[model samples]
Target: MHSHPRLPPTALEDCYSDLRTDSPLDDNSMSRLGSEMRHGVTSVSNKPKSADAFFDAWIAHVNETAVYGKESIDPTRSTSYRFIWRSWCKYLASSQEGPNAPYTMANPLLAVPVDVSRFLASGMKGSKPGRAISDVTRRRYYSVLQRIYAFCASQAWMECSPLDTLAQQDIPMAEKHTGSILTPQQWDACTRRYGNPAGNTFEIRDHAILMLLFKLGLRPEEIRALRVQDFQIGIADMPTLRILPRSGPAQERTLPLDDQSAEAIQNWKRVRKDLAVVINTNKALQADFNDDRLRAASDTLFVTRSSMELAKVPLLNLVKAHIERSCSEAGLEMPVRMGPQIVRNTRLIIWLHSGLEVDAVAVMAGLKNRKGFLHLLDYCSESVKQKIQPYRRRDDDPVSVTNMLKE
Candidate 1:
């Protein structure tokens, strides 16, 4: 049998206590065990062959947990977690010592806390050397590893998670606010260039997307999830866009649309239909097409020129590309980054400056209450700030001091 060092006496005592109790270990107890076992000593005698099986089981378990027993999960979030885990696994395989040398994958829960810290501090492989990742990204990496370790403990794979020893200070603090909102002039320039009605099919489609994002404050996910049936037009009251609930905290709400936004949607629909028909009728591509593709194209409001479903990432890329094009055409400096959220932020700031009630703005933005919209206040324009200057009394004003002296 391969010999491994025994866990500290404190860890053994806690393990005994855990065995004596019917209740599962809480985070605090697990944290105590983690601190005690930070040296990475373990006595599990499984061979390298069994280690592979354990690794596979651990991965499967993580996938199941993340999906919440559902058939599908969010692709972006799942990919991020998997990437971070694989990076840590590689580090462990290269850095493991003693008899476990190459078998770190077999017992990943035994990773040292200091090693985890080092992995976070080190620059990612494809990134520029010495250019450390952003604090937000490091936090996400730590969060993914912490969750995995906690899961392993729950499944009896480890006595505690080594990640519990990770210090809060090690996770750098992000800036309090980093908001980007376009001015009214910038928005008009962007619309004139990329969203012009005279432009081609792609431009018209992008224009409609930008209108929905800026005018109605719809999120990218909400826009991507939109269907042809969601637009209610030629009604007794007014044309409205029904935002269906997606995978977030926002609820479903139908928003009244102005003439500009309604017209943009109508123009895009005409162009989209023409593209769909051409793709469906082409005999050369018929063999490659399937029923699912046809159904998605017909039911989904937005589609690529090739008639494929337009997912969130591609939709965002389209927005960014058009914004860049618009910036160049208008001779304006392109934003460091632009996305659907920026458009949403710009709209919210506009509403606040327009003197719209916070409650009304929140409802239009699909937020639960006015408080939810407060975070976007940082994007308020200089004009808005100047508008409030009159409310404050100047330090030199004689009325202020004279009234106080008289009293």
Candidate 2:
């Protein structure tokens, strides 16, 4: 059993007692959550002035900045960025205050080294959901902290960013954490079970969405942002989808569209037309159209019958509900956990099984590297494993290894 470090007699006992319980992070525990920043300034500022204040201010600043452009900063990512700052504050509060205090505050967040180590350790343990975070994300978190401290120091907030000294510390790349995807056979089963009815737009649309993700390996946001113009039937009559660039300035990709998905898209487009006046002409879309840049945006992509506005979460939930309903109808075990992106993994595995090169598969999936693709192999079924096995190499001898000439 781990004992509490050198703390006060009563506090030390409390820490140790709390540690004895299996759960250190109880929701009801006040100390674990940290003090909420009370806004009315104390004589020295009743509000928090130390680490928490800096992070809170930065979050507000960035969120406010996100509103200026035609494309707002992603709300989900902004929420996460805020949470990351809060996590930092939690780390700071729990650390030991050394003999010599550099600042006026009695306690600083964990010492720079300690928190950095803790963050890296937390990443390695696969504590974060959606599989473990990529090494890039871990590195970004660390770098973001270093910047936060630098920002504080520049403002004379703290003597220095606690992480400034960690520059020399080697931060190793984290192992890739891959997600699950359904196979072609599994997908065929899912679609047959869910879709195929005349008025089953719900199932058909979802099945199509899943198909698009599997066939194209589109990112969630890219899939969500799809518009009517993104669909194109090539001169050879091949259906194709133009996947727009993601967060950064990346090249858009034109992915081949499957026939079933194309038929589903046409169905959705028809339904979208019927519901346009009812759903698409909402205040939000009108607001969107007010901007010249957003004027060309269409209302016929993915949307909910509940509302005209294209909300990411609501659409995702609707898709999941349809899936569950289909599972019930088909007598298949309902997935306890699933997401829109699992199809991307399915596509990656299929590509590998079809003997496509890793680089080609990466390009098709819009992945910048093969690391995640390789990691995804872990989730593949044994049949897919066998299917994905490399073929025997052949030598060019101009002679048949086996001749049927033997009498």
Candidate 1: where is the Cα deviation over 4 Å? Answer: 1-134, 137-171, 174-177, 192-194, 249-251, 276-296, 311-314, 368-377, 381-407
Could you list the CA RMSD of all candidates, in the order they appear?
14.9, 17.9
Pairs in clash, predicted candidate 2: 41-46, 42-45, 42-46, 92-109, 92-110
Q: For candidate 1, what is the lDDT?
A: 0.60
Candidate 2 local accuracy as lDDT? 0.52
What clash pairs does model 1 have?
none
lDDT of candidate 1 at residue 170, scale 0 to 100: 49
What's model 1's TM-score? 0.50
